[model samples]
Target: MKIGKIPPDVLERLVFNRRGAPRREVLVGPAIGEDAAIIDLGGYYLAIHTDPISGSIKLLGYLAVYVPTNDIAVRGIPPMWLSIALLFPPETDETLLDEVTKQIDLAAREVNVAIVGGHTEVTSAVGRPVAIATAIGVGRRYISTSGAKPGDVVFMTKSAGQETASILATDFENEALKKGINKEVLDRAKELAKAVSVLREALALADLATSMHDPTEGGIANGLAEIAYASGVSIEVDPSKVIVYREVEELCSAFGIDPLETLSSGVLLATLPPDSVQEAEERLKKLGIPYSQIGRVTPVATSL
Candidate 1:
């Protein structure tokens, strides 16, 4: 525990000062904790966001870029460019850095986005190498977390704890096998970890969505809290219908963790039009994506 929290005055002093300027071309400027910004050009509205790697290192830089990219997609946008803020510990190796850069490049290529500019530094301030990427993209009619309607069908594109299970397995392979995780499960874990990008299905449903969000650091439960809070609706997870891998459930039980609370990547939650739900699921199936309908967003419930 922290001995003393940073006082408000000290917290303000410790932060970087933003350059304040109002340019007509800049629709959104430097703001505290605003994950993404927006800019309006003559014919398009561009949404931008950036985030860093903190938890897992196997594909740290790669996942760093996509986490925010998923934000763009969830809001019905297509990511087109990237500007990265990569910080590394002083003892970092050039070869490891190269591998990280290659992963970033390959991932961006898979989504066909250009790497813009940002800072790269090796510093004592950073304990682990951190990759912070700022992504910019275009949108037509953007979906917001606040857009979920009371009756919108709550839909998911993949299982709960997909990335979390995969990351834990990769990070604790030896320990996991002793606990009964097999080759098949391990392979499945790696496959899920490798499945970080969440833009494809999101962009496909962009026009049809009223609201959406990527299930990331805080998992589906946290995601539900946000959507419910923002849209003023209540969502219930039919625990029976939530598709968590059996091994993932076992792993969570072994560690005394809630599978619902584990970080989930490669999944998107959409508050889709009731008329469009089946069509959207079919679209995801046609694209070879795995998905399941878990629940519905009912009118704000008094019971909860």
Candidate 2:
């Protein structure tokens, strides 16, 4: 009944339970923490995911492409094709449509994905424009958020609430300025929008990751909670190790939002073996992506 993602218990009861009979072709089906559905396609696995952008209208098109694509990427697959569905209100103007479609085109090209097919329509079924994208890709190996094991180190890419900062800065600039945030700080926060894509770092670290999660609606806190619940493990995170960009801090402070619990599409949370930490850091540094060792996974205690 919330505006964001459904609660786990409710999802399990209403959605996950009615996912139909298990099929041999479905290598990975619907689950709490799994990013995309993995289907066995003879020689390789097909990773597919769909996401809708209804929260922020300013970046709808861009978010439509990258959000779902990030899901497929976290599965260690390069998204190759996308299908977008654009639904607009009856009063929507032609210029808005053109702008959104253009953004969709530019974003798809930026990620090297083709717009294979999609549907667009203006109807009274919605208040504002909504864009949903489904991304598909093929890969030999896939990683799931449930794969994190005991003794694995938890890693986070970029900073906390990067997406949140960008969204607030872009869509709520006036409110931020009214709250005493300077124009320069707001502009810098807006720049964070371009860094929302985590495909590069996800692919680069996929090989070393036991599990990967794209923190979205609930930021790092929810992402970590999902991984822990899915993997049946306990994760201890050091707050000091989690990096929060200065702009993000200011924006969150202005809005009274907890950065750790805000939207964080750009951040990639992963778990890796202790031995792979050095290699992962090296690869990230070479790619110029900042990261941090935030925590470690441990087995949950059980009564004997």
Q: What is the C-alpha local distance difference test score of each model? A: 0.75, 0.92
TM-score of each: 0.85, 0.97
Candidate that scores best on TM-score: 2
Residue 245, candidate 2: alpha-carbon lDDT: 96
RMSD (Cα, Å) for all candidates, in order, is 4.3, 1.1
Q: Lowest summed lDDT over 10 consecutive residues: which window, candidate 2?
A: 53-62
- TM-score for predicted model 2 compared with the true structure: 0.97
Per-residue CA lDDT of model 1 for 1-304, tens digit only, reads 3432233345455642444566697654433222356677777888887776666766776786678788777767788888888888999989878977888888888888888888889999989888887788886656667777877888887778877777777777777788777778777777776677788998888888877778776688877777787677888778787777776776666656687877887888887878998889888999998777778887876764
The lDDT of model 1 is 0.75
